[model samples]
Target: MTPDLEKELDDFKLSHYENADFDSLTKKTIQLYNKFERLKDKKKQNRVVLDLYTLYLQATEILFINSHALSVTVDRFPSALFIDSFNLRNFISENFAKTTELSSWFFKLIFSVLKDNSGTNEKYNLYTNLIKEVAKDYLGDYDLLNAYKHGYRVKANHSQTTLSISVGNGQHFKLNDSDSTITYFSKETRDGVPIVLQHTLNFKIGRIFGKCLFVCSLLNNMRAIILLHYKKPVSSKDISSFYINDKDEWNSMFGGSHFKQPVFSLKGLNKKNAIPK
Candidate 1:
């Protein structure tokens, strides 16, 4: 690429990194939540909600990175940071991998706790199914995320508005009559081509963003329901234990101020009060 084109590409990529209005709120809300492990004040609880919403916004911001990656690849712009350009795609997929990993873990933790606490009644069963639907709808996304995380081959092949994903792992080989081994490359294929998706980039990215938002909404709804229905008060530790397995990991990523103690809780006091079924 020419120097002017390279500059333009850099400018384009940099644009993706621009801050949103809620970016400051995201940082502030997280800071406030971290400052108080168990927020008793109603105002603080509202801040916690904002923090959760901030997470959804951050996840959505990832789409800009996603869009930038595809644009870079399709344009075939070579960057000093990403000489192959394909690395950008891999990098974006890797982010998705991490998101899915954490989101899945969160959902599992919440559902497991709720399931264990509920009685074997139809109401509880229906609630469980509702949780299942969220997971079911995004099941493929979780699979793709896992594939990317494990170094299983995953790539997006795009031509204009049409995008197809190739997902597979490992290689196959055969020995010829001469005893020479031949290696084969596998792509997630449909009728001998990568799975063709009749969706535009906007659609695919929007779907991903929507799923992320749904998870955030789930977190909000689950907390509210547990507070309203469950007789026992749920502690922040109960919720944090499921997500924060490694202190070192959290400390390195978010600093000691964050995750030093449980930062989430139900919307009321510790007293046990029964909520209607």
Candidate 2:
């Protein structure tokens, strides 16, 4: 990387700081981006460095947005849960190794789905908020996935578009919902079930951006999964505990802030299990 490139990256960092509604950590992410960009230019264009950098920035923005967005999204709901990124990353990496087979598969699926997937022609500015690449499946857990949601929803609803994935090695995984409603009820269903999604690696967006994660969210008998998964895993208990009015956030949650707790299942009954109806 030349001095000019470094200066350009520095300028990019300044712009994100001067422009982005991120946090101190996010500012640090800009620095990380600069470092990674330099490495990417010189280190033979390795994709891992770029992917890690993207996850770092995305997660940072999510942390900031979760704090800020929640305050305004619902006054009654408690402020965003704050935890150090180091600790949070450690938590995710640790838990991921121990997660169930389905969960691990799900995390891999989210990245592959997002990575191999593309097409954002709607009114939503997801293109700017999200980028595509060989989406990495590191940090496979709920927190990182939920963080993606909290951050992206700060502006748009991704559920506005349906999740299309090739599950179980081209088994065609479909998130059971119409396009518009998925993102609308994101927070509620992201974790209602036992499955979780991890981190994603995407095409370089010049360095300063966030990663996307996923979870399951539901609405009025509608069961759907929200991906671009994030950190900040919200339990059914936590979301359930929050008191919501008759009105839900039109741009966010559907049914008041309060939600129902559903039993999580790591095992499932596949078709034709010899059960006669």
Candidate 3:
């Protein structure tokens, strides 16, 4: 946490003394703190308490950053922008380099960068082909988040409200959305794959910072496509030209020009669409 951030939040606690939402945040903070306070238990209670604490702290940080990131502008701190969920799209299009959600997975940034810096090449061609295939999978069309955690996703409808994930050891991995979670799993509730992934993920990151970093990585994947579009090298109108039928458009205006020249240009476009200054 930055010192300036601490001062600002402290000022917030002082000024908005009557706001219930801020009060709720404070009370939740205290309640969560106290849960971690007298943790005399050494088994399941300890783990549950710790995970809750971890979630609480990260969420608080998210709230804090959202309200302040743009305001804390400075010249010397380039690394700070890497975590900014706000200005991320700028990194993809310009020469500026920052870790963004879309390319959170390795090799994702390659296609966008290649298309921008160079005209279509073999590598860019392969990546563009792959991107079209992956784009269908990433539509995020409502049920996407609903189906992500569950093997069988709840079909999305306007009636569906919150997108929930299975917490805990994954014992009560029921799909009916009824049983909520009954503390730690006792091996009698679910005892299945959900528990497997939870436990496996636990083994990967055993500290607070590690877990938060893992979450940042997840943020990179969770909202990647929205990030991709904003960060794309060229404007969307340019993208249509690449997909227009090369053969069909070839004969219209620049007919017989294909054998003469195989490239697209604004002056050559028979239609008003493909022309760029």
Candidate 4:
């Protein structure tokens, strides 16, 4: 074969493998969750948390790229090579906000699938609320992801004492374990007085794993919906055609019966402590 043909074949193989990997995100998340459950060591748990954090970020990016592709007027589905140009936070705020067109279509399809698979409104709402919780967690803890990705600025908080900072004259800011398990600090000035800003975020390992799994499921189902309608000459009125016809497949892949909501917090810095010294 010519060199160009060989290069084409290699690209095809790589693309196929990456697509398969993307589809396996739900399974990979479950495997990590199981591993976390089986491990009892603190260090192991921390390792799992870091892994989950990485997976969560990747999944978020994939979902955003796919969602953006679907939102446009033309038929442009995202491939493995497609990189999202917008920052994750900005993309979510612009496209996934409560009032956005993409948000409406995306959540409608997700809720439809959940309701179909759940078999009852109660379970559907439970899963819906869980997704909402995870999305909120993603938005809030995004900065922590940046800290980890950029300069390795975040660390697991192992200290027994609450971190306190004196803003000069009498006021103080305190951060405890309850506030976050991971912490980072940066200095800034407010009205000529310099103060330390405590950036913190925390998550229960088990819950983070569970939330990641659910998010993967959500993205998987959304992708399925996009493909089902891809390039089809359908109008907005033909919404019924958009539903996933394979209920059993969806039930198996997007099931939320065992999913758990994430309990996490991202506390940036105390504004009250920014007083002039």
Q: Pairs clashing in candidate 1? A: none
TM-score of each: 0.25, 0.24, 0.21, 0.56
Q: Tens digits of per-residue lDDT for model 2 on 1-277?
A: 6778666654543333234332333345455556645653433333334334335545533533332322232222223235455554554344323433323433333333232233322211332112221112233223433444554521211122334467676687753222111111122224433332222222223322323221110010011012112222323322201112332232232111111233333336455542222
lDDT score, candidate 4: 0.53
Alpha-carbon runs more than 4 Å astray in model 2: 1-23, 40-202, 205-277
lDDT of 2 at 253: 23
Ranking by lDDT: 4, 1, 2, 3
**What is the C-alpha lDDT profile of model 4 across 59-117, one tens digit per residue?**
86666665655554332232423644445556666555433455556666766644344
Alpha-carbon runs more than 4 Å astray in model 3: 1-20, 47-51, 61-65, 68-277
- Candidate 3 TM-score to native: 0.21
Note the clash tally of each candidate.
Answer: 0, 31, 0, 0
Clashing pairs in 3: none
Local distance difference test values of all predictions, in order: 0.35, 0.31, 0.30, 0.53
After superposition, which runs of candidate 1 have C-alpha atoms over 4 Å from their true positions? 1-3, 14-26, 35-38, 43-47, 63-71, 74-277
lDDT of 1 at 211: 39
Residue-level lDDT of model 1, residues 138-179, one tens digit each, is: 322323333334332333321123223344765434211110
lDDT accuracy of residue 53 in candidate 1: 30
Which residue window of length 10 is worst by lDDT in model 1?
175-184
